[model samples]
Target: MSRPEVLCIGALLWDVIGRAPRRMAPGADVPGRIRHVPGGVALNVAVALARRGLAAALLSAVGRDPEGDALLAEARRLGVLTGWIVRDTGLPTDCYMAVEDSAGLIAAIADAHSLEQAGAAILAPLDDLPAWTGPVVLDGNLTEDLLAAIAADPRLAAADLRVVPASPGKAERLEPLIAARRGCFYLNRLEAEILAHRACPDAASAAEAVVARGAARVLVTDGANPAADAIAGGPTLAVPPPRVTIARVTGAGDCFLAAHLAAGLAGQPREAALRAAVEAAAAHVAGRDLP
Candidate 1:
């Protein structure tokens, strides 16, 4: 087997998304389309990377139930490696459900308790390796304690670690990675504001604030506005995404991150990588596949 170019660690589950055609208000029943797809921060990014021709592997926990079995098969079909994933017998597969409309996502729920419960077991692979030098994409759905431990682990000291907050609610959980200054963070404007404990009106400010908080690098995206990328002590590079009609908003960020990483791995310059990321995300939001 070929060595993986990237390792994605976190939740692997089903995404149940209900999207309405028009703007939706609270307690209003409306016609919509509901679909079930394989998703989760880690899985989404892994699939995106695979579509970009990267050898990505997943190190996460999934149940041994039918859902988990089918998800693993789907990942394999998509060219994402699954040998390192843990099949937990104690828990059922995890899931995420969200409601979206013309404006944007109205609400969502993530039932990733199994991943949180699996804890360090999912990371046991790292214990056998002396050091991992490849890039690792970490999902913030992990418990704060586990995130902190991984940030401080010696086995990953030389790794290029990229972190993503699974959602705005889990944004604060990435503080440990920020404090360690060992990971590149991918976040939306609101998530950055939550982590930085201040209001960030734009993606540029949010990127700067996150870098100032001790991140090695940061990428901040504001829906339809502009996205910004910055390295520690470097000038922010802001790029606007194509103003496309919203199709679905669930996996846009993951697609962006995967495209950016693929661009970087292919030796694209900073600005080029940022632009590629923005464009890929735009395509994804327009109901196009990443490839």
Candidate 2:
């Protein structure tokens, strides 16, 4: 396989989503659809980049199980390089379960114990690969210690990094990267608030707060509100997402991050890249097929 233009490092697993077309309440049984798909923070970003015709590789751990086998096949089908993925014999593949209704995602659980256990072993392959100067999409699924190590690792110091909190609960795990100013942080409003330790009423304010907290760059999003992007010395730019009917919300942020990175790599200006990211996210939420 050819060298990948990007490396997505983090959870590589399955997403079991139960979707209900109507509003749902706790303990309320509603007719809906349940499907298992190849997903995870890193996988989602890699898939999004691949769809945009960007070659990407996954640096993660997957169990040597049937589920892992199937997941690898699906990733290959989607054009994501899986040769660097570690296969753990003692653990089951990780998986995320979520319930979504017409309103949006309600609740979810991520069972990534295996990846957490595999830890730095998943990244060992990096030593053998050619020098990577392209964007490395990282997620908060890594353990705090491991994240801290990465923040100071010389191997990654020169690469363009784009980091995202896998979920609001994992937002604090990214503090190491934030303090190191290692990457451009991509996260939703709540995640931003969790990192900044303060309430922000809007995306622009959230972006500014994160940047002030030692982040090199930031992209803050609020569902259908406004999304903001800020660089250390540049003005924070905010743009509203195009109106579109809601379809799925799971990978929306990944789509936005991937699109923005791709646009920027293609030489789009900051404002234009942010606009394209918002547009791409809107299209994803509108049920439009990516790429």
Candidate 3:
């Protein structure tokens, strides 16, 4: 098989999202909608890239169970290449559960135990392939050891690595990447603060702090506020997102990262790429299905 333009590595599983149209408080049993969709940090990014006409492949683990079979089918339907995914018979498919209210994501739990348990087996395909110097989108959902190994692996040293923290809780798990200065980091304000170990009043401060901590490049986003994209020894670019009434919040950040990477791969200027990413995120939150 031919190599894909981009490879997404990390969690690939179902997203079971419970959304309520009204404000939610603890212990409030309000009626809501629950839907199971093909999701996960890597999968979401791959789908977003595929939607933009990019050839994207997934490098992750899935079970041999029925749910895994269904998810693989959905991934193919969405144009994501699953040939590199490891189907482990000993483990069950992973999943992510989230609760969202009108305000935003109230809480989330990522049950990515299988991917963590699969360890290095999920990455076996990379060993057989030629040295990939293209873009690789990596998520923090993988175990810390695996992430460290990937960071130091010579096979990926020449690739354009783009890493996301996955969430605030997993932010510190990206320390290996940050210490190695291996990739362009993508994260929201809270995740940035966690990684930087300081409170960032705004995106600009967060981006600066992360870069000071040896991040080669960083993008920090604050909802509705301006976002900052910073490169070492370069001017930090800050751009405000288009304000829109949020219809959903599960995959907005993934959409933003994918759009930015796609624009960069297309040779768009730095500022232009950041603008396109914010625009894509705004459209996603506004429930606009982008092509």
Candidate 4:
């Protein structure tokens, strides 16, 4: 296999999602669909990138258990490089479970304790970051301290860095990257609001606010609404996503990020890249597979 052009660093685990046909209320029980698949922020992005024909490698942890072995085999089959992935013999593979309804995602829980425990060990492969000048997708699932350490690591200065919060709950953990103006951030409106500590009525405002907070660049998406792309002290652009029926919400943001990166790497202009990202996300949310 050729060397990977992109490195995705973060969670790599099984996703258990339950989807109901209607909006779910607290304690409400309804018939839904349940399935297990390989997922997690970094893994999701890596899979999408691979589907787009990009050589992406994972720099994360999985256990040495059966689940981990299966997950690794699946990743390799999906064309994602797993050689750089750390296998923790002492830790079981991680998992994430989410509940979504016709309205969208309702609740979720992430059991990534093993990954958190693995910590900086996942990055052992990249000890010489300066020698690898490639695009990196950094997931916010990593501990804040470890993220801060990476932000301070001078070796990463030569790489094209992109940071994404695994979820809105973990958005604030990206503060160090923002303060350092290190990478382009891919975020939803809610995540942007959390990181900027303010209310943003729309994706445009959210993107601007994050840029104001010293992010090198930010792309903010609002569900079924316009998505914005803003660069610090530069241009702010917004594009509306194609209207489509809501399907699965999991991994939508990751698909958007991956598509945007793919577009840029393919020489698409800024406006075109934003449009492609939004369209890709809309398709994913509508139950279309990555192409």
Candidate 5:
């Protein structure tokens, strides 16, 4: 009856990615390699936590399709706790596809709208738990109404919440959390701007703006630039990413966030956690296995 180490709740889906060494343009024939692997914020963080030798559970909606079956098998293979996932009967499994160039991501598409409709079923078990404490990473792909509900819900309020904006389109959905000053946020410069509604020149400025918006704390990352952290009542901290060749951009931010949590949980200092996050994210973007 010890506490769960962490709960990563968000999209759990299949990712199909195509990559090419050269830059891409319209109507051009190109030779590229395609890689299909497990992805999504929930799965990525859960897998990373398991890889780091931590107990992690996934709370999200998944379909009962073949893709769901495969993902479930792999989740177990990676040692993530999947007992809390909500399996939907009618909806198909969620998925994402992206095209990447040597520079970074060129285009992407996500099919996760169904998960929005599935509501809060995945987290229902939290209310019945005997002892549920620890970090819970919440993503923004959820509907705004649902996000508001979660902000007010007693089941999740006790857990240390780490909030992430799933993507630019859903960034504004995190306003409820901002208003409630509930969780610590993980955001990129663009998503930060979307939530703050003003242009943020860098991660430092973004994190500051997030603090101004009533968030308890914030971590803002600008790709290849300096990252920043803002404690609820502490000073802003900034650190630059290590030099790395951009191979792809998919899931790099999630990797950074997960690595930060892992390092912090291991009793590392804030600077050390930031360094670990940078190294892990750099390795991910370079198409190497996480450190």
Candidate 6:
């Protein structure tokens, strides 16, 4: 069977992660090694999708520099389409550097300035694509204005759409989608709270709060208490993930999103999709084999 396209629209670049066996405190220098790997919500999701033997593409911006070239090459080699990536001559590929420990993520910084500054121009390439007739996995890293416009883009209403808030800080960007009834909302508990401006104790509650804000369906994930609330004539489900030692956290959410997308596209029921996503995410953070 021919696979449908999954478009990941956001920052794409190299990640420099420093791992430590134990936690670190302020001014406490730790011994760790740095490794450069392909990273970014869009790119990570694309990689996960490819790992599932799906057709995925990156519809974002990249730099004209070597990092961009190398990353693009690597993405192509992985069977992800890079033809939609806009190579800016002056802009540099963005990246995120973080320090992770045995527990989970502590403090990290994202350097996606180029992606934020590039604005709606980054999506221009998609206007002409004929093969991109499938669901687009939109990320929240994009500016609110761009996302709002996308929420109202009639061209995309022809295809299935799944939008994710990159995290808590950018969760508000997803509001337009809910307001316009464009796509399903995939958010963690904290992110769902941020979008609703309400405090929710669990994934189901967070999803209810998000649904109150006019979202048709909300996939709410809280580290282990996974719950999904739907409005498209579907059943709600609760699922739990296996506990394991934490290894990293940055790309975990992306892995979950990709797995969920793949599972749902394969006609699995909501419970199956939620379980699949949580398992994939658990495997990712635990540094186990891909789920």
Best by lDDT: 3
TM-score for each model: 0.97, 0.97, 0.98, 0.97, 0.95, 0.92
Total backbone collisions, model 4: 0
Regions of model 3 farther than 4 Å from truth: none
Model 1 clashing-pair count: 0
Q: Evaluate residue 164 in candidate 5 and report its C-alpha lDDT on the 0 to 100 scale.
A: 90
| Tens-digit per-residue lDDT, 1-291, candidate 6 | 134377788868788888788988867788876678888888888888998988887878778888988989988887787876777637788888888877777667777777877787777766676634587888888888888887667666566777887768788877788888778788888898898798988887788777777888888878756556555445556787788788777788888889998998899977888889888888888888522
Displacement of residue 263 (Cα, Å) in model 2 is 0.2
Question: Judged by lDDT against the true structure, how good is candidate 3?
Answer: 0.92
Clashing pairs in 6: none
What tens-digit string does per-residue lDDT give for candidate 2 at 15-62? 998989888889989889888899999999999999899999999989
Clashes of each: 0, 0, 0, 0, 0, 0
Taking the tens digit of each residue's C-alpha lDDT, what string does model 4 give over 1-291? 357899898999999999998988999999989979999999999999999999998989999899999999999998899898888638899999999999899999998877888888888877744466779899989999989988876666677889999898999999998888889999999999998899999999999999998987899999988999999777899999999988899999999999999999999999999999999999999997623
Deviation in Å, model 6, residue 265 alpha carbon: 1.0
Model 1: clashing residue pairs? none
From the highest lDDT down, the ranking of the candidates is 3, 1, 2, 4, 5, 6
Model 5 residue runs over 4 Å out of place are 1-3
Report lDDT (CA) for all predictions: 0.91, 0.91, 0.92, 0.90, 0.84, 0.79
User: What is the TM-score (0 to 1) of candidate 2?
Assistant: 0.97
**Candidate 6: worst 10 consecutive residues by lDDT?**
226-235
For candidate 1, write residues 132-186 as lDDT tens digits.
9999999988999999999987888899998999999999999888888888899
What digit string (tens of lDDT, one per residue) describes model 5 on residues 29-80? 6899888888888788888888899888888887888889998888889888
Model 5's alpha-carbon lDDT is: 0.84
